[model samples]
Target chain A: DAGITQSPRHKVTETGTPVTLRCHQTENHRYMYWYRQDPGHGLRLIHYSYGVKDTDKGEVSDGYSVSRSKTEDFLLTLESATSSQTSVYFCAISESPGTSRYNEQFFGPGTRLTVL
Target chain B: AQTVTQSQPEMSVQEAETVTLSCTYDTSESDYYLFWYKQPPSRQMILVIRQEAYKQQNATENRFSVNFQKAAKSFSLKISDSQLGDAAMYFCDRTGNTPLVFGKGTRLSVIA
Candidate 1:
């Protein structure tokens, strides 16, 4: 455990409803990312933040939004949940990209989200 | 676009046996990084090993080592003396300026 916790470890929501998943870290890492895993797709980056209030979209950013108000917390929100959004979501953090260490991503326990 | 391909969808190896999982990636960038991540049933992602594209020597970590063939665009992981704990989904990944691009993953079964 990297002192990372994801709220609502398991979430079940119906289509057209709003849902939010939270990720909290105790390490004060500067970089945070949200990824979703599905069969045959491996893991796809949904969104990532390099600093507070600064975020970027990843390969699969559509249908998902993210916010990082503080270094310790990053939130992923689905404005209107859809069945296509059902998957296991994972949160990862790493040292800033240029600080010498690369490819060292620490992951959270993961959240299983199901959309009906 | 960068893509990673893990040919083996499922593989089984007996305890104390050696097994190799194949991974091939396609990228135009000459300088990048390759990685192997393990996900047990627990669903936590663990780093197994990593290889810098510029490095010719294969990276090794205890019981886990990689056979990195840069010319062939292949990076395979070999686990020696397999243990039951080795059973899990192994994912091959690539990273550069963008986030990592992961392969579909190979489910490895360690039979006792």
Candidate 2:
């Protein structure tokens, strides 16, 4: 929902190859986030962006990088993909948090990525 | 640091019955928020309910309600009059100044 879309809903990449996942939102929200979901791990934040050209690392930022060049787009890049990097990635968007309104993060459908 | 824990890995509930999923969290901060998110087979994360730490009253939404005990650091979701459509993976989450920390999740199966 929230007018969010992820490209290549399904992707397969070879280990050591570089890969990128794209997230786009039409709601013009100021906050965008990238998360990976795994069994027993729930969802772990990979990286998040607060505004255009502003980003920060998350709990699991070792193998992930993100960039927000525009208000609607956020990209997560894997400089060198590995089998351990394969997981279902979800993108979420939220308006200014700490406010009572629009604080909920609406998630995208998710992308299933596999690294061989 | 904030951490969420869902004790029940899986549970089953009969149609038209009620079921409760347990969640416990650890946080030192006094002000924060907790949320319940449902991920069905489609894998889309849907917000079910939210509870503010400062509020004593439990949060409710139709058939869904939460038993939030701030002192106990426990937040549990109760689904009454369950429907088959309610079957999904439910995740418990907490957030303060940082991003949300989620529990592993509880898989709920609604039996007909």
Clash pairs detected, candidate 1 = none
- Candidate 2 lDDT by residue in tens digits, B1-112: 6789999999999999999999999998877889999999999999999998889999999999999999899999999999999999999998777777889999999999
Against the unseen true structure, what C-alpha lDDT does each candidate score?
0.92, 0.92
* Deviation (Å) of A60 in candidate 2: 0.7
Q: What is the DockQ of each candidate?
A: 0.60, 0.67
| Model 1 C-alpha lDDT per residue in residues A1-116, reported as the tens digit of each score | 57889998999999999999999999989899999999988999999999999999999999999999999999999999999999999999987552234657889999999999
Q: How far out, in Å, is residue B47 in model 2? A: 0.6
For all predicted structures, in order, the TM-scores are 0.96, 0.97
lDDT of 2 at A62: 95
Please write out the lDDT profile of model 1 over residues B64-98, one tens digit for every residue. 99999999999999999999999999999987777
lDDT of 1 at A31: 90
Which lDDT value does model 2 have at B47?
Answer: 97
Mark the regions of model 2 whose C-alpha exceeds 4 Å error after superposition.
A98-101
